[model samples]
Target: MPEVVFPLDSTRSFTDQSLVGHNRWHPDIPAQVHVRPGDSFRVHAREWFDGAIRNDDSADDIRDAPLNSVHVLSGPIAVEGARPGDLLIVDILDVGPIPQEDSGPLAGQGWGYTGIFATQNGGGFLTEQFPDAYKVVWDFSGQVATSRHVPHVSFPGLVHPGLMGTAPSADLLSRWNAREGALIATDPDRVPPLALPPQPDSAILGTLSGSEFDRVAAEAARTAPPRENGGNQDIKNLSKGTRVFYPVFVDGANLSLGDLHFSQGDGEITFCGAIEMGGFIDLHVDLIRGGMDTYGVAENAIFMPGTTDPRFEQWLAFSGTSVTLDGEQRYLDSHLSYQRACLHAIDYLTTFGWTPEQAYMILGAAPIEGRLSGVVDIPNSCATVYLPTSIFDVDIRPSAAGPVRIDPGQGVPRSSF
Candidate 1:
């Protein structure tokens, strides 16, 4: 039986016995599945709930939580004979949805990312009051689709084991043992269970951006504005057709993916429940050199069109907010807030003499659409910075106009034009 290496992460608490890196031989093994350049394969991933509950169908189920709620991704089928330099080519073939044939308790069959059934202020910014936190429930006897205000924005959870490396550097923080139900199957043999160590925190990451974006996220987290326009979901549009690229790391990327989403609102405010189940995924990996080529660097960066990027962004934006509430939201006017943010970001790079295409092309590759650090957290409606770490390869700085160090301590962040 040709095997796949489960992408192993060691950051938080994942358990070995948990379905972390195990693979279920679809219909056949690696050899039987013929892969061509354009050929696609539809792999039906198990739901995050793994079909544990019996006919559960209410948001309360998600709120109440189930036994295996921690999240466990499946896979690690070693390609028939994929090698180190070779890339994994995938195309999001199509979604083979698990119809309401056996509906989930918390997630309704008609549950889309937005609309009456959408998750509320999740981890996103909201002008709504905590006491008045609200979510409009939808009534659909079947599928989670709708023709309402939302565009047909579909995408894959495209999750991976997260830790696919050999300690790139000795000093690097090890994320192999992240506390969850996962195990690094070194030889296809069952690994022993291990206990978690005390004291910690965790999440996904991005390429090094010299901390500009990182600081921006931090500053936003610390700041808070009294009221804001809306709670933008800031979700990555992973509809049917989109190929995500990741620079090759460990052997075959030691990939693992869970947190699959049916639909996720932007800013991920409500979080990744729709993202909880697996999606039929297709991928094509390529080895691109010089990580980020032209996108300039900012401490905290986001590309134009907020809440949209391949790499996930996080922020302290949702403090004291009822992030725990589902279906809470409201939209507003100020369309330019997003436009201004994008324009400001592009202009920041253009100041370095790079054309918009240069900026766009470079940014298109390694963009790390960062989390929205809430200016609402602190005192100002401080705009969130769109920092893509890939900017480091471009060699520009916020203080490039002069040698200045910017941060929350620096009062306010200004573009050094």
Candidate 2:
């Protein structure tokens, strides 16, 4: 076992930890721990919601989930000698659920959840169809996940951290706030507002107090969107053995991460999607001085994905165009096309007795593939979603026999505002 630099107690709240972490992104959030560039260490991360979300069969928690306090990252662990204009190399050595404990109220104790957020809370990619909140709890056995709510399916989890990033420089953080705040000002009262602005209501900056805490909280950027600093990118391929290069904007390169997922499909389509869990991540850090400018990687993270991602020889695929369900056409909108593809998959799954929510959960939590298959084809961008055929208990491939129906047990739990 590596040296556990930041340890977390499964039964305690994130704020009660020995070395507290922040929920928002701010360079001023002092580094609670320090590691040398060549150090190999362990970090215990709380699930995004801390332990507020439960492992039971209800979507009430999802509906009322605290949006303000999220992503609950584990560090601003400064790397010694890491400086501006450099690139920090992060190697994910290992990651998994809580060590040694299998059963507990906390997530990642052999179980985790996938949730579709309510439109009023945080609308998902398919929120137009799934307006209400829905929840599915999946049990982990070795590397696979099986759900009672979404039955007749089991698949290997592609466990990885859903959020990880280096701290933003003051100028970069100002730019983030300016752009995101401008977007929010357009629809300040919009339900599930355009973009989350910095709010001091639930800000958690490490070890800061007095007016400094309030000032920093008001100026910090929310961890909901991925920015130049790499917050909440949600890339599922960043699993074990992946090497990532992040541009450093501040001295010491304060890096933080959390929101581990047992598995997630491409895009994490559902808003609160992925099999969200609390876990430990083993990391090894190094530096590439001046590599940011040396490689023209000035913003965002670039990575060589791990070779150990789950493999499936055959897949059932569905594709969709940029045309809306109501027949409105949009030009070159890959995001809209992907949403339509996922909706098409949900509709097809309903033919086999799985509820739409169950199908959406599968797409969010399984190792499914999503691709932009036709972006250059004129007005209509085309996106395709591929599901591993083996994950389903019944034959899902198109055949002369048509689709085979399987019993969907108990269905996903639901709650609405």
Candidate 3:
């Protein structure tokens, strides 16, 4: 075991931890832990919700989830001697569900959850089709996850961190706030809002209080979306053995991480997609000393993905063009095309006795592949989603025999707006 630099007790609230971490991104949030280059350490991360989500059947928690306090990250662990313009190299040595103990109230205690947010709250990619909140609980045995809500399916967990990044400098943070705030101002009343802005409510900056805490809280950036600083990229490919280079903006290269997922597909189609978990990650950190400028790595993280991801040779694919469900055509929109492809998959799955919600959960939690198949095809771009046929208990391939129906047990728990 690496040195337990930041230990967490699963039973306690995230704020009650010995060395507290922040929920928002700000350089001023003091680093509670420090390490030198070439250090191998262990970090215990709370689930993004800090245990606000549960392991039960009800979707009430998902419907009324606290949107303000989120992505409760584990650090601003200052790397000694790390300076601006340096590239911070982080090697994800290992990651998985909560260590040792299993079977508890939390999400990652031998189980985890995948959720679809109601459109009124945190809407997802296909929120138009799924306006209600839904929840699916999956049990972990070894490395595979099996959900009782959507039965007759099981797949290997592609455990990884969904949020990891360094603290943003004051100038960089200002730019983030300016752009995101402007976007929000455009649609301030939009349900689920265009983008989350800095709110003093539920802002948890480590140790700071009084007027200083209020000042930083009002200016800090939310951890909802990925930015130039690599806040919440949610890339499932960043598993063990992956080496990531993050451009250092602040002194000490204050890096923080959390929102661990046992498995997630590309895009994480559902809002609370992925098998959300509280877990421990083994990391080895080193500095690249002026490598940011040397390599022309200006922004965002560049990572060499690990080679040990789950392998699948055969896939049942679905493709969709850039057209709305209501028959309106959009030009060269890959995001819209991918949404269509996912909807096509969900419709196809319903023929095999799975609900649209069940199918959506599978696409979010499984190791499904989503790709841009065509972008240069004039007015319409084409996107594709591929599902590993082996993950299902029955042969999902198209045949003269037609789709085989799998019993969807109990169905997904739902809560409507």
Candidate 3 total steric clashes: 0
Q: Taking the tens digit of each residue's C-alpha lDDT, what string does model 1 give over 218-312?
A: 22110011001110112345434444332222333233344345444333322222333333344433332323233221111122222322453
Per-residue CA lDDT of model 3 for 274-301, tens digit only, reads: 9999999999999999988899987878
- Measured with C-alpha atoms, the lDDT of residue 120 in candidate 3 is 92
Q: What is candidate 3's CA lDDT for residue 328?
A: 95
> lDDT of each model, Cα atoms only?
0.28, 0.92, 0.92
TM per prediction: 0.38, 0.99, 0.99
Q: Is candidate 1 or candidate 3 better by TM-score?
A: 3
User: Which RMSD values do the candidates have, in order?
Assistant: 19.2, 0.8, 0.8
lDDT of 3 at 12: 92
